[model samples]
Target: MTPPPAPAAAPDPAPGWLVPGALVLRLMLVAALAVALSGSVAAWLVTRASGQEAMRRMVSQQTDEVEVVARLLASKIEQSQKVLRTVAAGITPGMLESPSSLEWLLQQGLPAVQFFDTMQVARDNGELRLSLRAGQLEKAADLDPTERDALRRTLVDGKPLVSELITGRTGEARVMFTMPLHREDGTVMGVVAGALRLQSQSLLPPSMTLPARDDSQLIVFTRDGTILSHSDPTRVLGQVRDEVGLAPVYTRWQSQAQPVVGRGMTHVQSDHIVSMAGMPLPQWIVARVSQSQALLAPLRGAQREAWWLAVASMALCMLLAVALMGWMAQPLAQLTFKARQLLKTSTRQRPETEMHWPQAGGEVGDLVRVFQGLVQQGSLQQSRKDTVVGQFQAVLDSATVGIVITRHGMLEVVSHQACVMLGYTAQELQGRPSRTVYASDADYAQVGDRVRAEVAAHGAFDGDICFLRKDGTPVWARVQGRGVRPEEVHGGTVWILEDITAAREAQVQKSWGRMHDALTQLYNRAAFDERLGQLMTERSARQRAPALEEEGGEAQGDGVVLFLDLDHFTVVNDIAGHDAGDDVLRHVARLLVSHVRQIGWAARLGGDEFAVVLPGCALARGQAVAEQLRAAVRAWEPSYQGRSFTLGVSIGLVVLDASLQDVPSVLYAADMACYDAKRAGRNRVETRHARDVSVTSSGRMALGPV
Candidate 1:
């Protein structure tokens, strides 16, 4: 039988499916390694970024502390300079010549200053004139080298000088502030000086009461490295660089053009963050130092924890990779083949073919369903996109105001109303630069910047601006707009513009009419009433204010009111026609305006009646003004239709005082005075004293005590 032809040379057993087992294991292992490496790098980057942020915050805090200390010290030095100036101004040559008188003067004045513990006055010749310490008079003597040098510098510059740290003759750490005293001829006669005691708590501001952390320090030092003040009293007046063992910091500070901040070694060989600021007035440096290691201890611990977490995640990923490698072998191979086939089919725009996946369950079935859903959803989304776009276009076209959408200030879409308002078709406006719709290049640039800034700050902007039509005519528009995404500088915006030129003109005319008379163009009764009410309210508020009370609340002594009535105004109107009467009245109004234009406001109350409010004119001066008005009326010769005659006016004067409660009371008093002047002579002046008054239910003034 030939043993079945020796098994017919059985074909080599089909290569055991190598893609299933070997390919899956290799892919999972590579993915696991990539995840582990990425986690490690990400953790390190995050830790480093957090540490940098913490360092930046610590440095900023130290900078604020140094700036605060410097400002407080400069302000204290300025206060001392002011005190020295006041003392210098009062000290005459006679007082400086007599030691006893000088000592007495200082004893009285020195008690007022809380910062300075000692004060001394010295002659230009370097002889101490007087010394006041703790409110006691002390013996005067020759000036020391520090005091003599400060005095000589002050004399040379004719300005104050703050000295460096000085050990007084009594062995106390002090800084001297000196100002020169000048004679009547501007010659230097003497020097006035004040001392800031380094050890005194009052020398520092009350707000300087900190928690007193031991590791932190504040140091005030001169440019040469001598310390003026320190948190540790023992270090006060010592050389800061030597005391703190920070020679590098000192050397860096000496050459620094601006403020400095850094981490450096301190006197104890410990790392510290140092912040330094220079004072402009006193020419000193202020520094704040804090232990860097102590500040960053928490961050270091967090870094360690982060590394451990990364390691734990890597182990978890390795376990997951091992488990996933087992099940994913067969399914991954089948899915890879199917995915490539599906992608190739999708590119051909073929009708989606139903995938004949194996009747397996779990991840394989879900993967098949996901692919089918993607194909079906893409078709549905395409159908809905057309409908939504159509609806958006409909809404945009129907907008009432001129609506526009712009990307980077270039027009993208415009509404029908926008086309009509700008005298341009949508084809002409869309895709064009927005500057085309502005009145000028400057208006486009300025208005675009302003509107963008407003939208950025407040999310919306509403303003009236000038826009140009296609015909190059300017249109006033009320523009309302909002940013689509303000935080992104390149994000576009939407604008709604309403034409408001006619409305704006009408508003202006209405506003002008409210404050002026239609005939004379002078202020009307309503304007007069509003202005007088505001003045009275201000005066009453001032009278009630505590500050005004402390200042004695003196009355405006020169305030006055002048009221006048034309004596023969009605007779002229009866003799001449009303047109001639109008001419006469206009001429009289012009005369009154010219007279009070400089010193006061003039108003026409009614027919032939006028009033003047003099803000700073006495009642006696008001009488002079009244006489001038009467003389002007008497000198005027009007020829109306072959009739020539002169007219007279009766005048009344009332002084404005705190006793008057309201404008009505003052007006009533002036009217009664004018009636008296008319009854007395019909052309003379009369005066009325302000009195307590009552108002009847008819709104008529009834003069009497309340």
Candidate 2:
């Protein structure tokens, strides 16, 4: 009747339910999302950059590793050269007049390893004078036109030459190292050559020719692109372009003109990483081809870690955001619930027991504030980027080795150690061409010719280099260089230099010590066996050759073995102590060496026992050498502590002929003869011509040659 009281004032329409709680929840969620996104993106960016740096270092290391392998292979090749040089140096004009003597000389100096299948000496007129194979002297084979030409070139060049690969009748690939024999005036009188079996473990290590991966391959080739060695035997002595993975690299390297001392890598293809190094000694190039995945394995793991870090940051932020929203909107949510309950009824209100209000403290900040944080975060990111760049430029600053960065040929950055090493201030070196540090123009040109190209292709270049300091002192450094970007060396290259002059000299000494005795300065037992065994094996193999039989070659052996025991060595050791014994032994070694100069190798077979291997010696000659040595020992009147001591030697000689089975039998027969000499009389000579012969109780030779 009162017109429904104006429709009950429409209950004031409930103020349209503003819903502040949901607004608070929405604002909190947005702020949380922004925070999570910013934090996650920042973490991801930081980690990704770090990951990229790590990848660069890892790839550089792999390239360095390949370079190391190349050097090791080069050392192995150098070993053969050293053996050949030993042979050439031991040649005398007197020995060359007698073909048998020269052949015996070759057998004595030949390497015992399976490195050389055949060794020979030829006159400058192309006459083959001496040929020894498998430890035995034999007739030289007729030289083909190609080999004859190579020999002529060797004589003309007056230098060592590594011949191109040759295929033997047995289908085996081999190479020849021709070392020129020089007179005092440096004339190339003749050539001493050793035939290299390409697959010989001594010439090429098993590790280099056998790759662990099927998709990978390693090869040794000449500057002309002729493959000298290969992981696959069938590919040895083939063309470089035949391998599918290496064709592009070969072409590119050829286009650039082959360098004799440089390293490089190629990745024109996506799947392969081809690294190569050229050796200075043999003019050979060592190339390693591997799958890209092998180099990128670390990069993938790093990227995954970055992604995980970003995801974890995002999840953590979202959890914090949900908690904030719940805490900040709890009171408002309750108030909204009560208001809706009241709206459902017609009654206005009894007084509520509790009141709730929304809190704004934990809610999202205003847009301006959010943007201000973003601006600061951007500045922080810039600062972080600068710090990262500085760290990169200063990496390994405290290391003793010098580190430098170069663009083109100019120095861009250098570690403190590099400044000290070059004897230049940082200000003096920056932006200067590295050419200033090289000892010679040739060295600088060599670096320019190969280092840049190699770094661009292979990522790294490593070798020993000589540099000139600011004070003009020459410095020998082992340098290892890698590109900042392997795909593009123009970006920059980093080099590490270590002083290695002392180490290099020490290495040479160490190598010498490996084969010589500390006390006698002569070949050790192992070295003696190596030389003696070569002679024995040469004889054995030649005896088995049908050609020798067909040619009516005599089966008589050319080597003579001698066994000598000091008659009164124990008296010296007991009366004057070991010092006198040592002196006497050294004197005896000198006499032995003098007697066999340029003809035989002498070794200390152990305590108080001495042996000699006389190549080209008959039984009569062997006996003469033994008597001379016995008389020399008997004449040695050594005085120790003002007391003169008398020393004598019992000598035994065994003619090492083709009839003997092996070195052991010859050595035992010689030993028995020496025992018989001692039992028969003091300071005398005894000779054994056959293994079947023995010493009777009366010290008389028995069981003569059948």
Clashes (backbone N, CA, C under 3 Å), per candidate, total 1, 11
- Give the alpha-carbon lDDT of every model: 0.74, 0.73
Question: Which stretches in model 1 have alpha-carbon errors above 4 Å?
Answer: 1-20, 113-115, 124-127, 202-210, 243-245, 255-270, 321-328, 332-706
RMSD of each: 21.2, 35.2
- Give the winner by lDDT: 1
lDDT of 2 by residue, 268-308 (tens): 35777677777776677887777766666777787788778
Off-target runs (Cα >4 Å) in candidate 2 are 1-29, 39-47, 50-54, 108-115, 135-141, 168-170, 207-211, 262-269, 294-313, 325-706
lDDT of 1: 0.74
* Tens-place lDDT digits, model 1, residues 19-82: 5545456677888888888888999899989988998888887787677777776777777787
